[model samples]
Target: MGSDEDAVLAGPFWYGRWDETAREHHGGHARQLNRAARAAHYAEGAFDPDATRAAIAGLEIPVLILVGELDFSPSPVLATQLGELFAPGWVRLVVQPGAGHHPWLDDAARFGDVVTRWLAGS
Candidate 1:
């Protein structure tokens, strides 16, 4: 297996509560760095922002965007922008306080409650 040290280091940025156990768990099934890099490259190349926006705009179903307050990559502001693409009341943006990229990891109970409530309401 490839070294998981890099994955462990990146865990903090991807997950709010990336502890040693989480690191080990993720690392256990981690792919080689080059393979991961290639996948990421392909994913990025395949993404089209305009197409995504058009698809989201055409959605008839309610959209719930959950963002972590502490996450910098797709910050709350970005989430807001995404929500704005949809008609008013069609998209709901919820910012989980003190959470990073992974809100469930930061606070499982609260995350579960929020998601459950939202789903129930929907």
Candidate 2:
């Protein structure tokens, strides 16, 4: 992302709550940094709608959808859509507060607890 977009979009890419450690860590290991800009272009082409429909229809088992509260890209809104798609069954949707795209980095303890509880069927 450009400098102007970094202040906003980049935050979602990393963490909602920024710190020196977070900045240093992500900066040192910015995976796919070279092709970040081209990702949009690569994703713009047509996708297989039939495959997507079949995949959604095949999700018969319970699902636990987690989203960061501060993530704008795949925010809780997207999680809600997934929940709807997995309808007529148990679909747990979690919006971890103050979390960005990487919820574990934003709130590791909470993320672990949530996932543990979900896995334990609580």
Candidate 3:
């Protein structure tokens, strides 16, 4: 697979919001320069629209859809729409303030707290 759409994915900083730490954590070093190609191959297979629809068709458990405030891939607006697909009373959507694609990587404490509260059924 090729990352022709985003050349940045071929380097240490795959996304604009990530810093050196995230790069290191995600193995962006020279040894893994080929990471992007592998990621590209899996990314397409990671989410199958038809499979997703089938999986969530009768989901009865609560769903928490969290995204970073600055994430545009599945923007806050889009996340909200996704929440709507679930039973209204069973969905909660949260956009972590000041974060990008990965809120936990950007603000670990806040991310932990948010998730903790949700898991506690707060």
In candidate 2, position 48 carries an lDDT of 68
lDDT of 3 at 74: 85
TM-score of each prediction? 0.72, 0.72, 0.67
Q: lDDT, candidate 3, residue 81?
A: 81
List the candidate 3 regions with Cα displacement exceeding 4 Å: 1-18, 26-57
Model 2 lDDT per residue over 1-122, tens place? 46744754565355777887567656655563666665764575546667776787677777888899988768789878867766467788999999887788888899999999999999
Which ranges of candidate 2 are over 4 A from the true structure?
Answer: 1-13, 31-46
Global lDDT scores for all candidate models:
0.78, 0.76, 0.74
> lDDT by residue for model 1 over 73-112, one digit each (tens)?
7999998998998866787789998888778868888899
The candidate with the higher TM-score, 1 or 3, is 1
Model 1 misses residue 49 by how many Å?
2.2
Number of the top-ranking candidate, with lDDT as the measure:
1
Find the 10 residues in a row with the least total lDDT in model 2: 4-13
- Model 2 error, position 116 (Å): 0.4
